[model samples]
Target: MSDNVYQKLMRVQSKLKAPKNQFNKFGNYSYRSCEDILEGLKPLLKEVGAILVINDEVVNIANRFYIKATASFISIDDGEKIISSELAREEEERVKFDLAQLTGSVSSYARKYALNGLFAIDDTKDSDSTNKHDKDNITSLNNENKWTNPKLTDNQIKRLYAIAHSKGVVAEKVKSQVEKQLNKKVEELTKAEYDKVCEAYENIKVANS
Candidate 1:
């Protein structure tokens, strides 16, 4: 689509306001948390045929660390919000090296206490999938023996994709090579290994395709 179409949609979205009761308790902010805003906006975006994505980065703060949260909205609208990462960074900086705050938004120092409320799904669940995995563990697209835990998060999937391609061959080709090297096919491998093999192949295909 053209940029003009996108701009027009955003203009319409800007005029759409949140409900009068949209405020959150305790925080005393008239505006909703980013998560809450997204929750409410999701259905509208879908109805209007659009998508939203977020990008985050860390900024140096007087020798300390802070995060910048950018919410990108696409579809019929295109406005964004950038909240202070101070709280998120403070909360994360205090964490010890070994503990896992799986669902916390370290940048905003926001923790997911309960699964209820408007933004619950986006809070803890989303962050967990983004920050918890190592990049090197990704299996190749064709490697049939690489095993992955079923509960891996979305970030893990992306990391796996990166790992699969880092070796110059697609994950599938690498997986196929491994199978050929071992003289066994994916079916010959155990169920535990079956998914791994497929993942390796998928990664390769994703990278090469």
Candidate 2:
């Protein structure tokens, strides 16, 4: 019985040290970003013969939009993979930016949490005591307004992808086209924007047919 993937990953995670490289002026505290963790993990991953992959998806459940970030660690020796995911909700108020910025912010947050979960990084202190901004807005109307902008469901995303694929369009190409058209990521699209993407792909399928 060889050592499992979890044990191998724990060995690497034990050697990982992610320093707080970012400072929050509002909260007067230091923190680390997802990039910092990734950077720190690079050499450790190589040493441990593991590969780290991070991915994001937007999910809509019950009319609420959430950014789901997943981090996977794959062992190069035995091809074993371990995955962890974290989700962050999209804010509704649009305090200073548009939907794109909001989605980007949430995506970054989700990624951070996903990495934290994967590496067993201690975030209780940072999140509980230093995250004054998030704590203050925890119950804000912007955060609570779940109905302002509806999101596309998983089925809708699958349908859109299927339509695009049938028309010889790759997922990246479709996502790039949608981003260019709306100046936002496909995951950040509102319900109307998502419908437009579906319609656009439908037109392509019709043309090919």
Candidate 3:
């Protein structure tokens, strides 16, 4: 009997070890981001003939906002896929960030944990679990713009897609073009890049009018 996709993925997951590549000065601790996990899993995924994909959706429940990130592993030879999801709430009051930034932060956090669940990555000693004082300081620093980026919200992304579709432009083509021009994935695009993409799409809509 041939091993299924889940078994093959488990084999890869057993060898995956994402090291802490970032340090928080305020917290005086090291931590791993979603990017770090993805980086570490790249070679392992290739070795196992699997592809990893991540996507996010925004949810509102009882006037509270949450970001749900879904991570999936797909077998290359067979089309079998395994998926997991995790949700993070928008810490609007705790963190002095705009709605978009809050959503992005929550999305990233959810994505990290979702991937962790899929890969069984143990985060027992991570900064979130330790260093409460440092975490508070880090939150303060984040509000001061010491570490934060402007990002697009789920609504913004949907608006962009709607504009592209209305202009008879393929949504995927526009996304690919923006990613190629900015040299980053749509999800990873910075605030400036996101604004630029939106502006370009707006221009297209205007020109066609």
Measured by lDDT, the strongest candidate is 2
Clashing pairs in 2: none
> Can you write out model 3's per-residue Cα lDDT over 1-209, one digit (the tens) per residue?
55689888889888998999987664466788889999999999888888999998876655765567889999988889999887566433343466566556667777877888899987755764333221221111121224333344444566678877877778788778877787777767654556667777777734534
Tens-digit lDDT string for candidate 1 (99-171) = 3442233422222111112122333333322233211121111113233322434434444445657646565
Off by over 4 Å in 2: 1-3, 127-209
lDDT of 1 at 44: 64
The local distance difference test score of model 2 is 0.69
For candidate 2, write residues 1-209 as lDDT tens digits. Answer: 65678887989888999998887664456878878889999999887778999898877766876777889999887989999887677444444446666667677777776788788898766632224323211111122433333344444576788889988898899888987878987777765566668777778634433
Using lDDT, rank the candidates from best to worst: 2, 3, 1
RMSD of each: 18.2, 17.5, 17.6
lDDT of 2 at 160: 82
Q: What's the lDDT for all of these models?
A: 0.39, 0.69, 0.68
TM-score, every prediction: 0.32, 0.60, 0.60
| Candidate 1 TM-score to native | 0.32
Give the Cα error of residue 69 in candidate 1, in Å: 0.9
